[model samples]
Target: MNVLRVAVSAALLLSNAFAAAVPSIKYCQNPRAVNTDYVGRDKNVLVQYTACDGVATTQIARAIEARQSNNVCGAPYNTSCFTPSGGGPDPNDCHVITDALLYDSQNIGALFTLDPAQNTSLITMTYQSCESFMVNQDNVALTYCRTDWASILDNLAFNCQATQNAHGGLSVATDQEWFIQVQHS
Candidate 1:
């Protein structure tokens, strides 16, 4: 009972703090567009804004929070480990992913999960085991940054096929995962 009370109090305090920190926001027909413009502007400027059609105030706050959490360069989907909160581009979290902006990035606005990371680790372990076997036999570990199998081995390692192939300096069976090229490697 005491723990529950403490939890409730903590929740209220955090909620209030979040409410205080967030900028003034409104829901409108084009909240997504408005938000895009707002976030893209110079940081010195302070302005309250809306998002695209169906985007809600909550989502706007959530997006801002996600960006703030990243606290680094680039927006969600454009960078790694940064998952955009709220679904896709709309203010409405309920909006179907396909209906999102053509620029919709962030793993197709899929929520971040550990599966891809785990897959990469698994594939890397397998590759390493193979490497050890080959190296013990006096074979040079032949590899290319082949990202073609990034998503297969670990979605987080590389996004698209192009990213995989062009992932300069990435390991094949070494420190990094070379999942697709496992057979060839």
Candidate 2:
């Protein structure tokens, strides 16, 4: 009886620990689409719609590729061009469709918007809650770290949050401050 009780307690503890380790989803803005028109002249371009967390990067990449190639055209028909790639989409090629194709930047601030419905599978990097640890119970530190589980959670959370709010009728707004810098400078 004693051994069985210990085993049950250990199992319960392990279960809780595993649950805690599972990361939660967090919304992340799409990275700015850098205009790859010229090297060292990367500029942020405005987009009509923003990508959603539920969308896959590969899908977005495929869509952009099709659009660029002009293999697909029209509204509803053209929309199919943005389908996620079944094989694998190159992250480098996936970008926002503006006046022209642009490169993707890591900086979240640089992200442009894309039509979530049209490009239902294009999302930027996933986000996780920043973690911190105390040193000697006197100092605290926080850092945003990436984990596979965390990335999945962030994507789920972002999708849920976006869906709950206005049924996913969200729009991407360019940071006016950042735009000013790019425009003036």
Candidate 3:
């Protein structure tokens, strides 16, 4: 009887420990479709919509890739074109700030709007929280799509805090004025 009691106690302790060790799953919001006019205008373009909050960078990269191609007629590449199709303030001002086709492996790319006539301003795209990071360069706002959470945290941690508000959207805030200096190629 003593041995059996000890065995049962050990089993219960092990079970409790194992239960406590389990990690809870974290949830992120889905991506949604915004700027449908851009999708409608282009026949070759595809849009995968979801809630902007908690979207992974890999998904954004896929959406960007869906709009990219080499045979398409464009200025950046006559022989090849690797550009994403998303509408913004300036229809002709958006381009991949990272290596054109290499964004797939890199899992992130910075996009900017170049108007050269206005001071940098935050361009609002009501589609994704990722776009909220956009800041106008000359006159065009700089934008980014990222895949890695760690990298995102590293860059935005210093000044930005992303929190889920009552409206079920991610809101980012900074302690003071926010400014980001990005180099373009």
**Cα lDDT, all candidates:** 0.20, 0.20, 0.22
**Candidate 1 segments exceeding 4 Å error:** 1-31, 36-50, 54-159, 163-185
The candidate with the higher lDDT, 1 or 3, is 3
Q: What TM-score does model 3 achieve against the real structure?
A: 0.19
Model 3, 101-161: lDDT tens digits are 1243243233333111222122222221222122211112223333221232223322222
Residue 67, candidate 1: alpha-carbon lDDT: 30
* Cα deviation of 55, candidate 3, in Å: 33
Poorest 10 consecutive residues of model 3 by lDDT?
Answer: 72-81
Top candidate when judged by TM-score against the true structure: 3
Candidate 2 stretches with Cα past 4 Å from truth are 1-139, 148-153, 156-158, 165-185
Work out the TM-score per prediction: 0.13, 0.14, 0.19
Off by over 4 Å in 3: 1-108, 111-119, 127-165, 179-185
**Model 2 residue-pair collision total:** 14
lDDT of 1 by residue, 71-143 (tens): 1111112112112221111112111111221113232332211111111111111111110000000011122
